[model samples]
Target: MTRSEVPSGGPGADEYDVIVIGAGPVGENVAERAHASGLSALVVENELVGGECSYWACMPSKALLRPVTALADARRVAGAAQAVGGTLDASAVLERRDGFTGNWQDKGQVGWLESVGLDLLRGRARLDGPRRVVVETHDGTTRTLTARHAVAVCTGSRAALPGIPGIEDARPWTSRDATSAKEVPGRLAVVGGGVVGVEMATAWQALGSEVTLLVRGERLLPRMEPFAGELVAEALTAAGVAVRTGVSVEELNRPAADRPLTLSLSDGGRLECDEVLFATGRAPRTDDFGLETVGCEPGSWLSVDDTLRVTGVRGGWLYAVGDVNGRALLTHQGKYQARVAGAAIAARAAGVPLLETDRWGAHAATADHDAVPQVVFSDPEATSVGLTADEAERRGLRVRAVDVELGEVAGASLYADGYRGRARMVVDLDRGVVVGVTFVGAGVGELLHSATVAVAGEVPLERLWHAVPAYPTISEVWLRLLEAYRG
Candidate 1:
C-alpha cells in the first residue's frame, strides 16, 4: 500500500475484482459502481488522479471563459452597460482561473477517491493478458495484478496536431497550454475553428490579445447550424478578432524558440505572432496500453459494444469508455458512458441478469446514437442537443426544421439590449417528437438541458406544449419554436 504525501486512496489488495486504467472521471465512476456492488476495485493512474477535464480541459477552459461571458452579458443590458468601460482585468481573471483549477493540485480529487473507498495505485498500467494488468510504479517498480471480472480502459485523449512540416518543432500550444497559460500572448494565431479554437480565441482577445483565427472550413462552428457560426463570427469581428476563413497553413517557421514565428498561409499571406495554437483534433491515448498483448491495436481507438465492453477480444472482460472508445469526445458524454459501463460491469460481476441495454437501457449509451449535447462558450454562446434537421434527414427521418430569431422571444429582448441570436427545433413528423434543438445567443447554455430532456425522453410535442415557460425568460423561445412547427 504505497501512499503519497498528498494522501492517496484506499489499499485493499494487490489483486482486485476490477482494475481501471487512467484515473479520470470515467475511471473513478467505474470504480465507484463496482465498489457499490461489493466488488473490490482499484485505479491505476500515472499523473494526477483527476483527469484532463478536471485540471486542463473543461475546468480551466470554463474558468477562463466565464468572466468574458459575464462581462459580455452585462454589456448587453441597458443600465448595466453604463457601468461597464475598458477591457477585463486580466490579472484578476487569471487569478480566479488559477483558483478554479486548484493550482494544478489533486488533493480534493484524491480525497474524493478515498471517501468512495476506491483504491488508487500511482503507476502506468497496461494489459499483460486476459484479466491481467502490469503496472510500472512511479519509483521504477513493476507489479502484476489480476482482475477477476473486468478491466476498463478510460485513458482519454491528447490534442492531435496536424501533420505539417515544422509543426512539431514549432512547439505550438494545445488545449492544455491554452487553458493553463500564465500570460496572454501579444499576437496569437489560432489554427482550426473547432470549439477549443474559437473559445480560446474569445478568451484571449477579451484578456488583451491580438487574435488571428485561421479556419480551413468555410465558417466557424461548422458542426452547429450555419447561422450560429455567422452570429459568432459577427460578434467576434465586432470585438476585433481576425477571423480568416477558407485558409490553410502552408508552413511554420520559428527561428528562435522564444520569439514569434512567421506564419505562411496557402493564400499567399503572412502573419507573425507571439503564440500559435493547434486546436485541430484529438488522438486516443492508447499507444502504450499493451493492447497488443490482448490482440488489440495499441495506438488505435478501442471498439466497444453498447455496453462499452471491448468487442474484438476473446472474452468480454475488457471494456473501453469515454474518449478512448471513440464514441463521443465531450466530457459530459464520456461521463454518461462511464455510468452505463460501470453498471454493466457490476451486473456481470454479481452474476445478475443484465438489463436490456439495446437502446435506452440501463447498461447502454443510447445518447451517443442521438441526443448528445454540446456548448461552445464563445461571445454569443452556441449550444445544441441531439440531431440537426440535416442530420435527421441524413438518417432518413422525415423532419421539419422550424427556425425563429431569438430576439422575438419576449424574455430575450428584456434580458439584453440587442440580443442577436436564433433558435431551431427539428421535429420528427412521423414520431411527433422533437429530435434536435439548437440555440445561439447570450445565456443559451442554461436552456440546453431542457432540450436534452425533451429529446432523450422522446417527449411528444403535445406534452411539451403544456409545459408553460416563465413570463420573461429565454425558455419562452421554446413556445415560439413549437408554434412555428405547428404552423
Candidate 2:
C-alpha cells in the first residue's frame, strides 16, 4: 500500500492523505474537499459525526424557531391573523425538532463519509506530534495515525458559562441543553441576551414558556446593530417576555429538593425560575487536545492565516478550521474555511502553485475576513453581512451609513401586514462600494446572501443597479437602500 494508505500503527493501523480531528460539518467538508481533490482522508470523532450544528445548535434551534416564526408571520397577515389563535403544539414541535436533528444519530453522515472514500474512527483524537494524531477509540484502545499531507483540526467550540458562585451546582442549561430540550419550562430564565439567549427565549416563549430574558448589557444582541436589539426587545416585550437588561446573576442554586432554581441578581434582587440558560459565549474545544506537543497552548483557540494553515508551525502541515481557529464561529463560515483549508492542503501536497495572492482563490479564506453574514431568527429577524457601521468606524474607515425605514417599501407591506423593520447600508464612501448591510424584519434572513455576495464580490454600486431586484418582494428593499445611499 502507498504510504498515504498505510495505517500509522496498531490493529486498525490506517493512514491517510489527511487526518481531520472532529467530525462536525467543518471536518466533514474538509474531508470531502480533500477526497474530491484525490486525497485519502480519515475523520476522528468522539461524538456524532455531523457535529453540534446537525443535532444541537443550527438544525434543532432552527427547527424550533421555524414554527414560531411561521406563526408570527401568519399573525402579521390580516387574513391569516384571524385563523391564528392559541399557542404552538409543543409536543409536535419537539417531535419535528427531533426529526430535523436526526434523532441525535449520525447514520446518514457516516454513510456519506464512507461514500466519499473518507474513513471514520469513532474516538477522541489528540495531537501526538507534528502531523501525528493519537486517537482513543470507543473501546478504550489507542491508535496512532499519521497524515501524509496535512492534519486539520476542525473541532468546534462549546458553550462557556459565566463565573458565578454556585453556578455549577445550579445546572444551568447551555446552548446544547436548550436546543435539544423536549419540554419547554413553564418559566424560563435566559442569561446573556446574545444570539443563543434571544433565539432560545423566542423559541420557548412561543412554545408556551414564561421567558424572562436577562442581558448583562443594556440591550439584547449587543454585537449586532443597536436598532436590531431595540426592535427585538420591543417585540419580545410585546409578546409578554420580561426583558431585563443591564443585569447579571450573582449566585445561582438549584435546590436539592423539588424546588425551582433560585438566582441572586446583581441588582440585589432574586429570581426563581423553573430553568435557567447560560448563553454567555463559546470557548474552543482544545483544552485536552495535546496542543503543547506542537508548542501551542491547550484550551486556547488555534491561530491560522488566510489559508487556515496554523500559524508559527514549522511546516504548513497543521491547519485549524471552524470554531477552533476563532476566525468566524458560524457553521456556514466554518464550512467555507474548511473548503479553503482542504484545497490548500491538497494543492500543497501535489506541489502545485498555491492561490496565495488571489483574493477570492480556493485556497484563501478571504470572506472570513471581509464578508461574514449572520441571521438572528427571532420575530422581526435581524440579518447583517460584512461590517456593521460601528465596526467600520472602529476600523477607522471613512464610512457613511444610510438608514431606511423598511416599512416605506411596498414589498415590506406586502410581505406581511404591519411589518415594521429597518435596513441600514454602510458604504465605503471613498470606494463608492457597499461595505456592510443590516436588515431587521419578519423574513430578512433569506435576503442576507445577496448582501453577502455584494460585499464579498466587491460589486460596485453602478454594477449592482443592473442586478435589479424583483418588485413586490422583500428583496426590493435593496432598491430603497440604494436610493437612500444615493441621497
Candidate 3:
C-alpha cells in the first residue's frame, strides 16, 4: 500500500505491539526489527522520516566536504595535481549537497517506511503514561497511541547555541544551516573546534569563504588523541582557515539584518564576519515531549541499561535509543542500539527470557560501552575505535600505547607524494589484547572496522600478526602497529 493508505493511528489503529517515537534511522531500525519479529509496529515522526543524518547532519555535510576532499587528494599526486583546477565550483557543490538531501523533501523516506510494513504517524509524539503516547498532528488534531509491548524513544539531538549576549539577535548558523544554506557567506566565523566546526570550516573555506575557526579549548577534536587534533589543525591552517584556540565569543552584535556581525571575544578581541556558526555541542531533543507523565525528567537525557531499557521505569516497557539515551551519539551506534532494543522487546513479549547478562548476546548493546568507532572527516581524517590511551588508564587497566608514522609505511608513501599521518594502538597489558586504536591521516576511515574488530573481539596480538594485511595498502599500517607493539 502507498504511504497515504497506511494507517494514521486513528481510532482502531491506535494500538500496536511497538510504538517508536522519532522516525529517524534509530527508530526506523527498531520498528523494522520488531515488525520482522512477528510484532506490529507504528513509527511516529513530526518531521522527515529519514531524520537528521539523511538531511542535515551526515548526508548534506558529507556532500559539501566530498568535493573538498577529492580536490585535495588530487593535488597531493604529482600527475593529478597538474591536471586539477584552481578552486572548487561552489554552486555545483551546493547543488550536489541539495541532491543528497533530496532538496529537503521526505517523500522517498516515507515510501521506504511504507515498504517495511510500518504504520506512519505524521505528528509530534509525547509520553502520556506507561505504554501510552499522545501525538499532535499538523491540522489541529491529537491521536493517542497505546503500545502492547514497548515504546522506544529515538528523538536524537539538536545543535546547542551558547548563552552569549545578543546571540539571538545575531542570527548565528547551526549545523543544519551550515549544511543546508542556499548561498555561501563571504566571511564565515565558526565557533567551537569540534567535528562540525572543523569540517564546516574546511568546506566553506574551499567553497570561497574566508573562514575563521574559534575554539574554546586548547585544541580541536579534544575527545581523540592530542596528536589527532594537532595534525588536523595544521592541515586546516595550511588550507587558509584562521584557526584560533583558547578563545570564545563573549557577545555578538548585528546592528541590522543587512550588515555584517561584530563579535566580542572573551580575550578582549573583536571581529567581523558575514555569518557565524555555533558548533559548540548538541542537546537532547527531549523537552516538551510529555516525559514527565512517566516520571522521566523533561529535557533530560534518558539513562538505559544494556538492553536499552530505561532505568527506574517500573514496568520495563519504556526504552530509549540514539542521542536521547546519550549512549553513543553517532548514527550507526544508535541503529545498533535500536536492533538490540527491538530484540529485547520482542523476546519479552513472546515470553522468551532476555540475554541481558550476556555482553555478546543479541539483546545486549555491549558495543556502546566496549567498542565505539568514530571518524572526523576533516582534511586529514581522524578515526578511532574503543577506548583512548588516557581512557584505558583512567579505567585502572595497565596499558601500553604503540605509535607508528604513516609516512614510514610503503603503502602510504605510494598513495601520495608526501603522506603525513600517525597511528596509535593501545594494548591492555593484563589481557594481552587490543583495547583501543587511533589513526590520523588521509583515507584512514576505511581502516576503522579492522580496529573495531580487534578491540571488540579482544583479538590477541599474536593472532593479529597472523592476519597479515595485504601488501602495499593502507591496511599494512596494522602490521606496523603490531610490530611496534611487540618491540
Prediction-by-prediction clash tally: 0, 3, 0
lDDT of each: 0.90, 0.89, 0.91
Q: Which stretches of candidate 2 lie over 4 Å from their true place?
A: 1-12
Q: For model 1, what is the error of residue 12's alpha carbon versus the real structure, in angstroms, after optimal superposition?
A: 7.9
**In angstroms, how far off is 423's CA in candidate 3?**
0.3
From the highest TM-score down, the ranking of the candidates is 3, 1, 2
Clash pairs (backbone) in predicted model 1: none
Candidate 2 structure quality by residue, lDDT tens digits, 8-48 = 35564567789999999999999899989998888888999
TM-score, candidate 1, is 0.97
Better of 1 and 3 by TM-score: 3
Which tens-of-lDDT digit does each residue in 1-487 have in candidate 1? 3242212222635678999998888888888888888988888899988899998989889999999998999988988999998889998999998888789888888888888788888888889999999888886778788899999999999999888888877889999999999998999999988899999999999999999999999999988878889999999999999999999888888998987898899899888999999999999999878999999987999999999999989979999989999989988998898889889999998898886787898988999989999999998999999998888999999999999999989999988987889999999999999999999999999999999999999999999999999989989998999888888
Q: Report the error of model 3 at residue 172, Å.
A: 0.6
